[model samples]
Target chain A: MSSKAAQKQAAPDSPQRVLTGRQFMLGDHACAEGALAAGLDFFAGYPITPSTEVAEHLASRLPAVGGRFVQMEDELGSIAAIIGASAAGARSFTATSGPGFSLMMENIGLAAMMELPCVIVNVQRASPSTGLPTMVGQSDILQARWGSHGDYGIVAYCPSSPQECFELTIDAFNTADRYRIPVFILMDEVVGHMAERVEIPEAKDIPHVPRKGPRTAPGTGQFLPYAADADLVPPIAHAGDGYKVHMTGLTHDERGYPSLTAETHDKLVHRLVDKVRLNAADIVDFEEQDVDDADCVIVAYGCTARSATAAVTQARAEGLRCGLLRPKTIWPFPEARVRRLLEIGKVKRFIVPEINLGQMRREIERLTQLPTLRLNHAGGAMPTPNAILEIIRS
Target chain B: MSTPQPNDFSVVHPIDHLMRADRLPHILCAGCGIGTVIHAYVRAIDESGTDPDQHVCVSGIGCSGRAAGYVNVDSYHSTHGRALPFALGIAVHNPSLTVTVISGDGDLMAIGGNHFIHAARRNVNLNVICINNFNYGMTGGQVGPTTPIGAKGTTAPQGSIEHPFNLPYLAKACGASFVARWTILHVRQFTDAILRSMDKDGFCFTEVLSPCPTSFGRRNKLGEGLDEVEMYRERCHIENGAENLQDLDIDIVDHEQPITVGNFVDIERTAFHA
Candidate 1:
């Protein structure tokens, strides 16, 4: 189907994937289908609430397709193995919720530092530690960006629906592979359990990113694993090929070994962080709903965005010039565009109805310096359309 | 799949022929039993003719964590307490990849204690060479799972009153398929323990009584790194697994009690990795 045909079928206000056939699938299940569509060949994960379905789905499906799925002993192992598998020339992913994401932070930093490309699906849940494994929360936004230690760039996408779960996961892999960094599918427990309609297009309909192939053989040619092309993202040669690339958490040179010199560390840190910051616009995927000519805008993401969209539609019926600025990509946040909306004085006030106690609200307010209201919760009970509409009306 | 037989291969050094044992990649501290223990493990691999490429060694944070980096293999250094989980990743990803975890005592006992216990409980086909250095040697010489009674360290400025973890008993309690313990001073014995642990088809935990001299020794007046080596020599008793901790006297050859150094448990269990 053409983009317009699909968009028209989906319409502005319609049941998600309106024209697509549906069967029962949890948010995490849709995410697994998304990974499969994205050519996911390796899955390493520890079973956690809400996110377990993704692991379960991949475990059964990946092996059938001749891919590898490993239920790692824990989330730390889950992300570590994913990095190793990715470096070994496989599209890899892992799924977890709450504390599991915390456990993955260190190695995820290593993935970011080493510029290894892979996807991490975090099915958000209430936490400080096992706080409500079955319940949902959006408290990990700030954590997702800064969770992994050190200064670097990362791409994180939040999908509000199972279909987005399916779609964004593929985009997550594509962006990660293309840029050679870790990408996150930040879904919360609410979206994780939500069974929705999703149509997975043909493999040909989807785009796949194979890593940059080697320029020369191991012995004859020079190929620094950390050496970047004109695009600024480095091409890696897998280990077995014997090019001898190195990876460490410490600051290192292009050869991938530990280099203590200040100049080497500076260049390593700069290039490591710059590529993502420089090309964030191309790497980012976000959605701009009906925000033009609006006096009020609801800026939300994940499941909250779904409700905010409904609230926007309901408020419009009451003759309120309100719109929803739902972000499909959360990190490297759609700052330029959101700021553009404020800079041109397009929207008066942005309202963020997230599950947290104003996590993303402060961000919106800070960037736009506009009055933004946070209709927040800890995510056990999802914010209803009426709750969001009340905030908009207020 | 090619079962390695030690002595069939040439006995060569890891980094170089005249390798300054100090220049080893793991960079073991002066008195660490793990460095010597790794020396034994490398010797076994070389003597046994195991292809280092096919052998993937995994390790967690802490003192013994650097073993994977030192050895010439498809090595992985995962986060603290997760060497087992990641090793399971490599093992299941390629069951033929002789996956092993060389983890530290504090790493396995305190933080990753759960993964260690569960991996033992599940019997995943991964070899775990747990170095029980008795305290948090890498971070600070704090009282750890293997820290004996009255052992003073950075954390327990006063002699510790907390009961120390007995590595053999813990692994046996956790249902580890093969469990053993030996200090670095007992090089041949420790290597013997590792070789036996490696043959297990399920989760194997070989807790080596490694010493940490820098943090653990100096503060406790156990002497410097090499000085701490004598502690391991004097305190350990070569038990044949015939007696229990309760039966063994904690007085002679003792750190509260001479460590029960032997293969305490080995049972045929199904592998979870497959």
Candidate 2:
């Protein structure tokens, strides 16, 4: 059930109608289409709220593209199959919500440790555990960071729009490939399931990135698998490539064999950790909206980014100077931009309206050290614009 | 032509080093069961003659995780209770890599039991050597997945109410292709079982019942009464392996059945990736 086929836009019965303009697509559907366009060959996932359409769309679409789609036993098995497929040289991915995201953790850490590139889309929901499966919440912020134990780094991206969901998903696959790490798309349920005007870009405009394989053979001396070059990613020789590459979750040397000594442990851990953090600029992608004459800044991400833009527009009409700070790259959180806001004296009251009970709020409070109200709602709902405006007014 | 040959410094040839006895490149602790397992593994590898880097060893958290660290082969040390999935990942990725999961009983049967059984049921082509030390030797000998019932130890004060996992029997029931059990006491038997496991193409699991000698040894009378060597000899037996769990009779602290060690299950099936 695997194929090396590329996904093209659907052809219509009236073929010669002189097609112009753009095709409208749902955010979740765009993600599926984007995955196919980016050369995703295999998808294994279970149905979960809001994000179910991504699976449904892919299940029907993959076969048409001559690719593989499997509805696995459960989220755990789904992720396991995807991880298996990814390692087998198939550009693979899975989409899930709160509970499913938790199930993917075991293999997520495996991907991080083994340095296998795979994308996981988590449609954020309200949850301690299955709080509100159908509702929206950004409470999974910390879970995305330290959910899998050990001292390793993973990249998480949050797209504000449906178009971004499509484009950023392709970016997620590219980042996973380039860094040799697991990259997450932590889209809020609101944006994920929401229908919007996503202009599906033609293939020529889409920026596609592929993983680099080793140039030399196994017997060559300079063929250490974990040896990092300028991009902080080593040339990954696939398992079938005869390059003799070994990968694992254990602390290991540059050669990827498990290491016990303090020196190797320190070196190996440093490389895994530093490789992501050092190249943050190449990784960090975000947008700053309307900060020229703003006094208060609402730093937000995911679905809240959409709401914050609305809140800013409303606040501007009410004659309150406010700016919207949105993060596209959620991981290695944009500390520089927050610092930039403080440096510019544009942000006085840094208020963050998140779905969780103040996960990223703490980061803002820590960074700006200004009065940052969590302005949080529990699981199952998004923070209302009126509530956020109240915090700004106060 | 003063070129240093790959096989010149070592007693065993590099070709044997592929999946053979001489390519074990790890440091050994004093009388460690892992060392014995490595000896058996390399010898089996020598016999099998797969590529050195092609034989990938994956292990979960614990001292056993260090096995991959020592070997000069393709290996992975993964999170606790996760070697099965990691090994399965490699097995599915490259069917040619002689896959092995060198982990502890706690890492497998305790926390990793679900993954272990699932892998067995799926019958992925891999070798799983669950180093059963009766207690969590890596974590200072807390009770392990293989800790015998009525044996006094940490986490089980008077005695363990929980019965230990009969690994080979469990694997056989779960559709593994090869299942065997042995003790560190008998080096030759352990090696033989590992070799048989390597030769078998499906999910081959060998539960090597090793003694902690320090933790389980100190707490139980078996540590004092029966020396480590004699304990395995008294309890272990080579069986036809077709014997069901109900038929076997064993008299021990656990009192379930004798630790039957042999080529228990060897069947034909498609691999996970293949």
Candidate 3:
């Protein structure tokens, strides 16, 4: 297919594709809208707590805009279906919580190995296995990074409110398309369920990224599907397009044929990791306030960052030097900024507050090696602003 | 110029254009029937008259799953027990493409059973081919969901105590539009059945009883792969319009019982999309 035809099939400009202007919306519902704006051609999901609203909204909305949505038999099928759709050159995604996310790990690894671009939204809830399904938790930070076995690089965005949920979900899709990797939107139960104002821009204002098509023409017998360009990402060809591409989960050579040699595996694995790692400067995003001359910096993300922001305001009113550093991109962990804060030498200590038990704290501690304090709650509730204030005062 | 001799190297196999000859020397064991089944499948595709580019083959993890890798078309070798859902994704997203899943009995009937029944219940448009070798041939002949009662596998040295599934009946019960059964020895019938299924509108299933001489056949005293083919040739009977599918079950231990094989179900239904 021509690139123009592929783009038209992927992103149809229907009136129902976007709900313009500000409106009161749940975070999950806003996320569904973001996907539509990002030209989501397909969505396959199994309903799970704290994330079902995204699937429920898309069920009716997708059909209205000439897209497809399928509620699969289970989480395993959900992930697998999206991966297949992605390989067929559709912008696909799925939503789930902790338990369902656990079921999707194996196929997530398959998607990584195949280098299929898709999005996965995980609305956080308490869990060691079905721990509070209806409550809030930020415990899945590390799980999002290393849940799938093997070495690969991933991109994840933490949306703190309904508005960020709308914006970051679109960013997630663009990143997934640009890098040909699975990007995640990590939302907690608080942000998913909270009703707030979400300003959705018109469809023209939304930035859309299309999947890169094969450079070679069909029937030329020269199309190597796994051959990477200068960006270390391979172009994809869909089924029925006559490229006759072969994709497998095994270690493959540039021709997409299984090559079970250590040299082949080592080359493929390193490219998978370095594609995101070397481009971290462009992938990572964060927000900071009053950190230029502060005695302590509180690093947080997700809904906990909401409370941390308030704590910083309260500390300023009481003549204390406290600042808030909120990370928007979690996986490409915003390490450069944190390292800069440590080297600036104005900060005496770092405070990390989250709903989980010191998940993000360990990341900060490892990166900075400075005095990092954890203000943690197991789940079901956010850390109170005063609790975080107390850590800052210490 | 003199006529080319028979030993001249100018001639190639007829189906060479439809296969990835560079990836040859397939991983199937000696005397296995999967290669024959693949040949029949490729012949059916050729006969169907559909654009080769529009035909996609998906497979799960097993020896038979490698069928996707050999076919020179847009194909995928997905994770274990997930080919049905994966193919469902491709079919639903692009209805113009003809999607087929070729997998083993253990991969399909055991681990992927839920997906199979649900896909049939929804009447999704897909052609699913299950190669039943009566055991997990890739894993060295362990007892699988289709290992008949009183048969011996590596894991069932004392003889398998559990009953096997009647695949056609299960597929018919789950509302498939077309269902059939055949052995690899019946290549003409198998290829025709595959073409018939491909021409149908909803979920279609075909079970091919193949020989695993290295695994299931060696342990069960079934002699070589040719001997197993002879058994299928002598013991198999055609009963296309049988009323009671319940009697279609196979008992390999009972030498007196004849194996029933036919294209049993063919009807129309609304296929699932989106």
Query: How many steric clashes between backbone atoms does each model show?
Result: 6, 10, 0
Better of 1 and 2 by DockQ: 2
Off by over 4 Å in 1: A1-24, A42-48, A56-90, A114-116, A125-136, A213-225, A228-232, A237-246, A259-266, A292-296, A314-322, A383-394, B1-26, B192-200, B219-267
The residue-by-residue lDDT of candidate 3 on B6-110, one tens digit each, is 767565569867788677668898889999888888888899998889899999999999999999889999999999999988888887788999999998989
True contacts kept of each: 0.12, 0.29, 0.70
Q: Compute the interface RMSD for each candidate structure.
A: 9.0, 4.8, 3.5
| Recovered share of real interface contacts in candidate 1 | 0.12
Ignoring the other chain, what TM-score does chain B have in each prediction?
Answer: 0.85, 0.82, 0.95
Ranking by lDDT: 3, 1, 2
Candidate 1: tens digits of C-alpha lDDT, residues A71-171:
76677667877887775566889998878889889888878876778899999887667787788789889899888777888888999988899989989
What is the TM-score (0 to 1) of candidate 3? 0.97
TM-score of each: 0.83, 0.82, 0.97
Checking candidate 3 for backbone clashes, the offending pairs are none
Tens-digit lDDT track of model 3 for A1-394: 2242234353377767989898899999999999988988889999899999999999988877777899899998999999988878888989999999999988888888899988999999987789999999888889888999999888999999999999999999999988889999999999999989999888899998777888889999999999999888899899889998899999999999999999999999999999899889989999998888998999989899999999999999998998988999998998999888878889888999988889888888788767889888999989989999998888
Model 3 score (lDDT): 0.89
Which candidate number maximizes TM-score?
3
TM-score of chain A for the candidates in order shown: 0.92, 0.91, 0.96
